[model samples]
Target: MVEAVMLWNEPNNLSHWDFKIDPDWKKFAEMAIAAGKAIRSVNPELPIVLGGISPIDPNFIQLMGSHGILNAVDVVAIHGFPLDWNHWNVNEWPAKVDEIRAVTKLPVWISEVGASSFGAEEVQLFGLQRMSELLLGNVERIHWYSLFDLPASWTATTRHKEAEGSAYYRHYYMGLLREDETPKMAAAEFPEGLGICQWFHYEDHRLDSAVEWLHRLKVRYLRTGVSWADSHRENAELWFDRQMKALEPFNTTLTLCFTPEHLGIAPHYTSPPKDPNTFAEFAQWAVSRYAPAPVRTNSAYAMPEEMAAPSVLR
Candidate 1:
């Protein structure tokens, strides 16, 4: 069952959001608020999560809060990669959680956090252990970056491919399994009950293998995405149905994100949509189709037959 729905991915990061066009994040905030409200309209009980912000910036959180974005969603999430991308030491995980918590009363979740085996598998092994120690009980949820390494054929999402050099390569090795489906050292001793962050592209071949691995790990929670951009592809609904069905066993957090190229103000996926309502309508349709609110008929509105026996004379 899908336990929650996230508005987007890392809206503050350059790779996921084109901040140059929306320097103040006002547009992103507007889009998120619309998406959150739409999700709630479908299933009021469903938890709506703000896209996990990358770099753990408190100022950005404050900005979202100022726009009343906080009121539209149930939880605030963040993404961090101390070993691979973050500048701070790994031990500061709790402090980072505190920083987000200080700004809002809503629950804080570590939507994505991981270490990459770019240089050595041992780095990922140690990262898993240390991350568990620091973050296991500190946050509401911790979804380790991925279950499978990104294929070498695909490019990592980044604005500057040349400047990102090592950081760009690290994206491929953040998974517990290699691109060939071989397990890394860290996969064997992975902590139980923790969430995993594994995004499946439209018709991605790794969906079955990822499900097997999640079951093997006794994972209870999963954080994945359904891209609005990919909705335009032929047979996209077929892939979406298959992916969601395959993952239905786990408690999932489905992130609805990415602007369709034509819908974007600019031609990029990171560009804000020309109409925020389009994104909201998509979110509403997804939730209503996939996870609708349960129906409950009130006694006052019950039919006469359902309430009591009808008189023959009547």
Candidate 2:
């Protein structure tokens, strides 16, 4: 049984992709409400989280609330990126979380928060520590953006072409560790009780080292993904078995995200499934295979039927 489900991640920050429609708040709120209702119907006890909007925008929460999004979900989430996107001042984060809480009158979560090592590792470490201290009591949870930096080759291959020319390139170094799996200063200084977001595509041999590092950091919660495309590929079950085996020793709570690919959707991975039944079936298989004590699927575009399908709960 999954503990909580976040509908999407950073929906307000669509600058990284080229979307077919104008990314408006109204549409986003409507989608969130529908997805929340569906998730609640399937697992009445599970928490339904509104995806974090980026750059600490309180007005977005207000806009979503106006559309009844506040009533649809149990938690309001926000990304705490105090260093990037011209938000250099770290002092503003507490007030930002407070602002959102005031509007939504719900538990606030800093779902995606981290400072990239764009300038210096020490600077990134300092910013991360300060942000954690400030956010300690203000929010329900804080998940660091990443655990390992994306390998340059992996970034080049996976990122959309438009991302190549922008500041998005800096994301390659956002992890607490470099691509080679060595720890950075931020890894050592990561506050206790906070969660981390790690990429799910690590090689088999690398899992032990990754777990070792996570153990050293005293990490308790791990947010990772299960890709629909990967599951359908050759030898998929074998691959998942290995990953799960590697992860078992750590005994960390898992938040497994479901990411199904839809062909016609722009930017590849961000699109919702055209066939809800197929997506629900795939989600069921993933849940049964991992049987993660708590699973979390990500998407703002998930249809209500897709979430409520009997296949998803079984």
Query: How well is each residue in 1-314 modelled by candidate 2, as lDDT tens digits?
Result: 23455665655665421234435555445455655544444455556667667756788788777878888878877776667654557888878877887777788987778888978898789878888888877676777888888777764322345455545666787899898888888887788888776657734455677778777888766655555556656676777667776666443323333334443144354444444344435544444444422334564333344333232321
Please write out the lDDT profile of model 1 over residues 4-109, one tens digit for every residue: 9999899889889998998988898899888888777667888999999998999989999998899999999999999988899999989999998999999999
Candidate 1's C-alpha runs over 4 A off are: 299-314
Using Cα atoms with residue i matched to residue i, what is each candidate's TM-score against the true structure?
0.94, 0.75
- Worst 10-residue lDDT window for candidate 1 reads 305-314
lDDT for model 1, on a 0 to 1 scale?
0.87
